[model samples]
Target: MILISLIFMNVFAITVSLLIIVADKVMSNYGSCKIIINDDKEFEVNGGTSLLRVLFERKYFIPSACGGKGTCGYCKLKVTDGGGPALPTEKLILSPREMSSGMRMACQLKVKNDLKIEIPSEYLEIQEYIGEISVSESVTSDINRIRIRLTDPKTIKYKPGQYVQIKVVTDEGTDFRAYSMASNPNRTDEIELNVKRIPDGIGSTYIHSLKVGDPIEFSGPYGDFYLQKTHRKIVCVAGGVGLAPLKSIVQYWKDNERHRRIELYYGARTIKDLYDHEFFEELARENENFLYIPGLSDPDEKWTGETGFIHQILERKMTEGENSEAYLCGPPIMIDAVMGVLDKGSISDDRIWFDKF
Candidate 1:
């Protein structure tokens, strides 16, 4: 009697396990879904995948600095129909006006059925490029200045201060990382990037390990952080690797002979952290309208230049009002501090363009 009872319980458990496996196979299938983009282009994709993933897989490159994590708020799109309502995670990033206008984070929106999405026409022009590493040199202890020459296209046209996305494949999966172009815009055949090593950062690690002649895949020419056409005096602030885009802008100005009065305040923790100082100093010597100021927050006794936080020094030096436009790129805390300084000087939000990393 005991043996028969044990046998019955074992059979029942086996039956329950089998049922669960069958149920998963049936429920996990979400068939094909249609994605209508910009009302003209259409794609058939498998359902139950994030909209960002689908677009990326299809090579419709979107600017996602955080790679679909929804933190950067860079991958917003307008969904006219069939996208359902916004998720809770999206609410944290989207403004009320944006939400009312059908804006949604593509990373958080799942493709459940046929959907219509509106993306910017400029994004439609973005293309993937194949490039080979031409040079990889260390600018600082942790920062590497990498230059890549386009192989397939042989050329790329992008405005100064714009950035590109580097795709790195690892054992875990593929990841995309964005880096500003440090090379001059006039150089169409090659582009340069300033990569700073982060603690256990997958993208930086991969980039640092790259050797000359290594093949690289990337999509580019994104971001509105480029230098605007303004006669206003320019005040540029950069910290650490944030100087990448600023370098491009300054280089462009040098090449074009733009004589607009410009003042650059670059900050680093110590003298050792500073890179490309000599280049800017030479520019200042050559161009009467350009001024380069390098500040060290924690300088040693050998340091003689400006000391302390950069924002404080900028506030002391900058002339307030609508006559000047400010461009800032740095960590969030530094950006906030600089913004406060700019606000106190009566620089309106519109004239203050910043990229917070």
Candidate 2:
């Protein structure tokens, strides 16, 4: 009698599991769908996938640092029609104004039906490229500079200060991380990036482990952080690896606009943390208009150039912020502190652009 009871219970459990499987298949199926981009191009894709993945499969490379997890706000796009209300995860990243403007996180928005989407015209130009690692060397104890030579497309056109998203494949799955280009944009055939090792970070660890001839896939030239065409003086502030984009910007200026006045204030914890110091110092020596200031928040007895945070260094040296364009990149707290200094020095908010990562 006990054996019969156990058999009955097993049958019941199997029946319930089968029912759940059938229900999931029915509910998850959404059939075919269409995506219209800016009323210009259209794509036919299978429904039920997140818009970010679907667009990427179609070669519309969207900047998603969180790998379709809806954590990074980089995948925001305007869905004019057929997109349902914003999801809660999207609300955490997007502002009220963006929500009202019909902006939605591509990673959170599922393509249930036909959708109309709008993105920047520049996004259309962003394409995926395959490259081979040409140079992989350590910049500091934790930072590495990796240079890749484009193999497939062979060349790329991007402004200095823009970034690229590299695809990292691990045992678990694949992920994407954005890195600002450290090399000058004019070097179209090859691109360089500065990656600081983050403890247990998937992207950084993969990058640090790369060999000289390893292959890589990335898409790019994204972001609007490039240098603008103006006669105003340029003020750059960097902390840690945030100097990547600024290095690109300053190199571009040195090669093209030598007459423009540019000042770079770099902050680190110690002298060893200040990598690429000699390059900026050489630029300053070559160009009278370029000034290099390295500051250390915590220094040893031998340190002498500047002591204190980068904001403190800027506050003491920035005499004419008026008619100057400020470019800042660093941690959130550092960017905020430096912006406050730039504000007090007469720099308008409109002229101060920052990228905090």
Candidate 3:
């Protein structure tokens, strides 16, 4: 009887211990908090969560291309008060200029007490979308220009030239990558995305392997690189797989019959990488306001198109201070070169928007 009592007591103790551990997390309350933004707006929120998650719940969107994984430093908020310490993960992403300005990665800074953080007013305009993969189709050479039909409670409202983060599930776990929405705005039921097969990119590998019926997870309508509401002339530049967002921008123009005189310079190493040219040319023929210039940087003998570096042609075509907005999407190197050329030509920084892959 004494042995039986001892066993019961031990079992009871273990169960209590487990319960306490679980309760500490689920019922762990951090009490009240304050988030002061730009020293103007003060939001009282529950503390003890990362600033990223809290701000999102509060409807203040911070751009995080990596989905709060601390990998992409897009979600930097100025934490002027009550954020604990500068975490090692945050240290990895911060630049000297960002650190000096008290900017910290929102995913890294936990709200130990009250906190003050700075964010762009534009962030307030961003929204979180729980999107499903309605269709994932390959358009060209292992590259997929997938059309993700938004399911669930359905309906997604977004501007052309914006992007979303797809949660890629792998054997290890899940990771995130940003892709531009290539769908036209006329249809809100489904949006489109173009994905390049990165050699070992966790997301792209999984994407390449996914079929039509697989349920996928995604979020956002992020980035500031959209067409400005203006009558100014435009230049759209893109590289290999960077045509995704620019395609969205053009789709918007076509739907609205936007009459801004536009020139698109799409560059690829060869004809194989170039995509959707026929469709774009169709638009050019229909709308005299638009023109298409597809260039093959390193052309084969059989290639019978514009065969020169794209920037050189751009230098000759675009007028300086023409009140033109230039949208670029491509690799970092291409973007920097174009930025330099645009700067030399007196294009204001405000007139430029891009998503560098």
Model 2 TM-score, all chains together: 0.96
Cα lDDT of model 1 overall? 0.90
Q: Estimate candidate 3's RMSD in Å.
A: 6.6
Which 10-residue window in model 1 sums to the lowest lDDT? 313-322
State which candidate has the highest lDDT: 2
Using TM-score as the measure, which candidate wins? 2
Q: Tens digits of per-residue lDDT for model 1 on 215-242? A: 9999998999988887888889998899
Candidate 2 colliding pairs: none
The digit string of per-residue lDDT tens for model 2 on 96-137 reads 999999999998998889999997888989999999999999
lDDT of each: 0.90, 0.92, 0.79
Kindly indicate the candidate among 1 and 2 with the higher lDDT.
2
In candidate 3, position 70 carries an lDDT of: 87
Q: Which ranges in model 3 have alpha carbons more than 4 Å from their true place?
A: 1-50, 53-61, 67-71, 84-97, 110-114, 118-132, 316-321
